[model samples]
Target chain A: MKYYIGVDGGGSNLRVALVDETMHLLREVVRGKANPNTLGIQQASDRIQQALREITEGFHEPIRAVGIGISGAPKAIAEKWLRDTVKAVLPFAEVVPSSDEEIALVGANGERRGVLVLSGTGSIAHGANDAGESLTIGGWGYLMGDKGSGYWLGMQALEAYIRHEDGTDTRPTSLVERVRQQCGFKDRFDIIPWLYQPAPDSSKVARLAPLVLEEAQAGDAHARHIVEEGAAELALLAQTIVRRLHITQPRYAFAGSLLTHPTPLAEALCRRLRLPAPPQPRYTPLIGAALLARLTVDPV
Target chain B: MKYYIGVDGGGSNLRVALVDETMHLLREVVRGKANPNTLGIQQASDRIQQALREITEGFHEPIRAVGIGISGAPKAIAEKWLRDTVKAVLPFAEVVPSSDEEIALVGANGERRGVLVLSGTGSIAHGANDAGESLTIGGWGYLMGDKGSGYWLGMQALEAYIRHEDGTDTRPTSLVERVRQQCGFKDRFDIIPWLYQPAPDSSKVARLAPLVLEEAQAGDAHARHIVEEGAAELALLAQTIVRRLHITQPRYAFAGSLLTHPTPLAEALCRRLRLPAPPQPRYTPLIGAALLARLTVDPV
Candidate 1:
């Protein structure tokens, strides 16, 4: 019997799974901060090897292949770390390492042609064709271009408070109360000194999306407007990626935790695409890696 | 006949006007950055003296009442600064100093019982009844609260770009191009380093209100929504202040360069207030200050 391993490394957490030739998730393990830049190559490799050994200790069969999908892992340093670390741990296994986004797309729809829209700590759209060609639209990170993502919304709320507080822009949003509370802030003036303190985690921003969506759902005009606009933008990104990958009427599967929530965004995507939005995929994109391990595609 | 001087000291510019007893402006002088905090008290004081000297340099007559409206002058420090700063320069002039917003309100209306909404590099709403009692709504400053102001709008645009670029928030706003051009920022990642730098003026944020309003005017949807919200918020503030000031049917006077643009905020305020939108006053708020300076009123 053959065995396989799949790993999905993201901004906040890392997920790993072991499966037999049949793509079922036999066992899994989770860890914190697996980004090579964050944990350093050797340490990240050690963590991965330790986790994998703990999960698949007594499987008598040789490992077929191991696939890793990691955020911020495209850097040569990251890739090398993955290769060296995995090689040292599971010396007998073939490892196919890729971006966390890439595996998310595969897991979202399971080898079917589709677009994957992801929004959590950050936002990006990735799609793959029947042929391996893929493309992306916006995934610039919080500083430049992750519109409608978690970080964007949080920062946006801060902006509104500042404008209102500063006597320049006056837009009342129900999210203000939550925003101020979450930031441990009382008013806009505190933001200058506070934001200057340190580089906060990218995922911290997404926390506001749910509150904004709930307010929108509850008939807060500002929240509703924000969701509608955010949806339109997510749709634009999905559509752009679809066009880029020559995916006509592709089945898109959303793979982010944000997608699981009933945001106007996914609903808007369905409306924009004129296709029924699939219920959140039954499994996570990490499973896509397991499925990859279970595949019979001839590697010619 | 007696004469007096009124000065509007803002972050970027200063306007000093000399007026005769009937509140007629004789002449004026303009300069820069007289906010004691931004430009130190010495530097700002020098500019203030320069402005007063330029406006009444050759008059050779003592001004009966000199009312200088300075921006960023908190009440606690207003007295000491007024005693030392203004009096130091114009020994022959009686210096009566108040906040820039208060002076702007008096400037916007020749002599009226109502609310004055000032939106410039910052925003604040202050209202006074016939009894001389007053109340304030917004105008916390760039760090805490300044709703319906320019700085808030600019901050919104910058955050939108960051969200979009990072792929966290998926909303697409016209802010993409506007922020790029305004900040000359190349992309989302480019902002990471710049965000760590030191910036004192919140006026930079206020600068984006017009740009936001313009985009809304062009129907970018999100931009328009923000403008509408901004307008509505401004109206709410006006109404709040009006209620607090106990003026039932007061004329709503608005000042600030933002009013010069085609902002729906005024209309929104009209809608929110359920009152016909008043015209931009016959004279700017600075002129109103000139009127107050020329005529002395001591609740007789």
Candidate 2:
């Protein structure tokens, strides 16, 4: 009875799964963040090692392979660390490591042949073609890119509020009052210290995306504009991937809170991309990693 | 020969000047950053103390007053720190502390009247009226505002580069190659690591503004549009201050690298504001601080 291990190492949390040869999930373990960029390589390795141990604890069947999909894992250092950690834990197991985004793309399509658009704290698009070629677009983080992301929407909302307050905006927005209420801001200047208290936290800012979406659904013109612009930016990402990959009528899957959670942004993005509906991912990233692990040792 | 000391505590460096009762400069000393926000309060204080000791060395005339104009000094804690630091350094001297912007405003007009528009790493407008009432507009830092700032322009350039690369932007730009050359980017993905090396530095981003302006001057439609939009945003800042203060035909002054330097952006801004030329400041900020120091003890 051959078994395989799959690790999904995200920025916020880590998930590990043990599966049989037929891809049947036998056990699972969840732990803290394993993103080397944020958690440090050593800490990420420790988390992955601990999760692997817990998931494979009682199983006596020799693990055939281990697949790790970690955030920023595509970097050589992170990939090396992941491979070394898996090898250390499962001495006889073959290791396959890739970025968390890659696993998500594979999981979304149940194969490596579709486009995945993710709009979490940051936004990015990844597509894999049948010819074993993959392309990425717009994962530039908060400072450089992340267009149509939660952080981007939240930033637009805050900018609108400031423009409205300063009387510099031609288009009036209710964001001034809405943001004030949402952020519990007593004075307009309160936002300065709040934003830069220590430094800009992308997650904290991303948390504001829901408010902007809610306001858009509530028929606020400015909020609706922000939502539409964000959706358009996201659509551009998907379209660029489709064009670059030369994939005709590619299946598009959505990830992240803004896209996955039934919202106007998702609808707007689908409309822009000329899709009838948002495609659901076939499996979770951990499952996708398991399938990849199976492919590592038994490529069919 | 009673002397007054003026401290101009900027983000990058500090300037201290000794002036006579008539505001004649006697001696000057330069030091490292004295901004309490960036440099610790104790370190900023120590820098000020050291500058004071050095400037007053071999001088016998009793120091009458000290004026400090520091970045972020308008905040209560920062202001208190400045006061205490000055009092400690010059026990017999009266201390007058204000924000760097306030001192620049005073120095630009050489009085407590008129508007000063500064477009450095961050953009802001400050104006004072006859009734000693002052109004501030649009100094919301890099994330929230700084709409027409050096950081703002540079960020726009980077965004344009990404959009152009991703084929998401409608407007064509020379920024792709220009920025690649200016930043020495080996590959497009190199920008991501460079921008987030540790965290986004506003000054570093602001340094890219010149390339953007140069591109605009050299006939890049997208770059020109960015410059025009930036100038318009800055004009809005000045216009808001003018309207709020109800000061008809207010004298305007410019400061900071982007504005003070002869650049197309400055010309665009002046054109937007309908100014014939950029107004030069009547005195430097350090001299303005000395003038304020004189007014603190001898209010005439």
Candidate 3:
């Protein structure tokens, strides 16, 4: 039986899985940060090897092909290292390394025509046409940009806290203390380090956005304002990507850390963009990569 | 000779003077931080006594009355305590002890009619009616509210630095690096202890606003934005004070830490107010207090 391998490398963790050509999950494995910036090429490659080995321990089935996806492999050097590394170790196979974004796009489209609005550690909106063109917006990072991401929303909440703390604020903002306690921050003293620290994962604090949103849902004006702003930006990104792909009437799907709940942010994105109820992806990005591997290898 | 004393007690230094009823300075003495919040009220009172003793040592003129300007001596209890303390030491005198704000107004107006804006270590705008009724706005405190104050502007600049340290930013934030270096923080590790260490004097950092304005005038957008925002707020405060006093045609003056030159915040304040000419105070707050001393003993 022909076997296929699929990899999804995230900012903080890596998830890999092996599947038969018929699409049954054979085995699964997990590892630490596999993004090249954090782990570098050598370490990422070593982790990949261990993941593949652990997943295929007992079986002697020859690996047919491998597909790997990364959160941000923006440069050519990163792609070259990934493709070469898999080829160097496997000895038996065809290897493909793509932006985790690319695999997510394919997964959302089901190899056809749909857009994927991603709001995870970062935020992005990308679409694939029958002719394969791409467009994006609002993924410029945290500063001088990034309007829709969790970090962007969190930063705004922090600004409100700061304004209130400094006394120039006419606006009543107990939200600062509310969020402070929620995030385990004792005072403004805790904020300076969080703002400057280069944590092992830049998205570590982003995980706190949902709690802030829940606060907003419970009628906190500041928290609600933050979520509303985030959603509006994400919606704009989706609209821009859809227009750029030239899909006059486009249907798209969204996935990522933001999809964990039917978040107010997600709800706002749909409402703002006027997007109808879109399908939510049932299978994980790894499952999508495995499906892609089966297609890329072709058939008899 | 009927001698009158005018004393300005500060956290850093105290300046006391023996002047004639005409408000001309005859003798002067200086001591250190008598505001007990910084040096304890007892030491502050002792410093006051020392400054008085040195100035009055060679005086044969009967000291008729004394006026002292002190921070933290708000309306009733604090004011009564300060007046009692000074009276106990120099019993043969009519003593008038009040807030630095009230004395600043009296000095700026020279025992006549006008408005005084105080922007010192903290910021507040206050005025007195011809009826002796007084009102104040802003200058709540460093933590509660002091919009357009030196400390407010300084905290705003710090927020900009925090943004730069987070890699999510793209703007040219070289100013943040320069400011951070001043505190000996190479990274976030040392920044923690340094930020939270005993009695963090956030005001020192605020003293950087004028420097920031200089940088802004030299084409730094961030600095310019900070100063401009502060200027706008100060102007608004001036307008608010005017509105409150129902002064249709008002003659106004300013005091405090932000009056320093070679910066845009003050310039912006003047420009936004559409002042056709520069308004420089003819006398300092001490002189203003002396005028108040003369008025308190005014034989109306």
- By DockQ, who's the top model here? 2
In the range B235-285, model 1's lDDT, one tens digit per residue, is 767877766666877777777777644466566556666666545666655
Q: All models: lDDT?
A: 0.68, 0.83, 0.67
Candidate 1 ranges with C-alpha deviation above 4 Å: A1-9, A13-98, A108-113, A129-300, B1-3, B17-20, B23-29, B40-64, B73-97, B117-126, B133-249, B252-254, B261-300
Cα shift from native, residue B97, model 1 (Å): 4.2
Model 3 agreement with the true structure over A166-251: per-residue lDDT tens digits: 44354665577776776677744455446554422236556666666777777778778888888876776666666666788777
Model 2 alpha-carbon miss at residue B22, Å: 5.4
Predictions' DockQ, in order:
0.08, 0.69, 0.05
The ten-residue window of minimal lDDT in model 3 chain A covers A136-145
Query: What TM-score against the true fold does each predicted structure earn?
Result: 0.61, 0.90, 0.56
The iRMS of model 1 comes to 6.7
What is the model-wide C-alpha lDDT for candidate 3?
0.67
Please give the ranking of all candidate structures by DockQ, highest first, separated by commas: 2, 1, 3
Itemize residue pairs with steric clashes in candidate 2: none
Task: Give a tens-digit lDDT track for model 2, residues A41-132.
Answer: 88878888988888888788899988788887664446677789998889899998877777787777777778889998999888877777
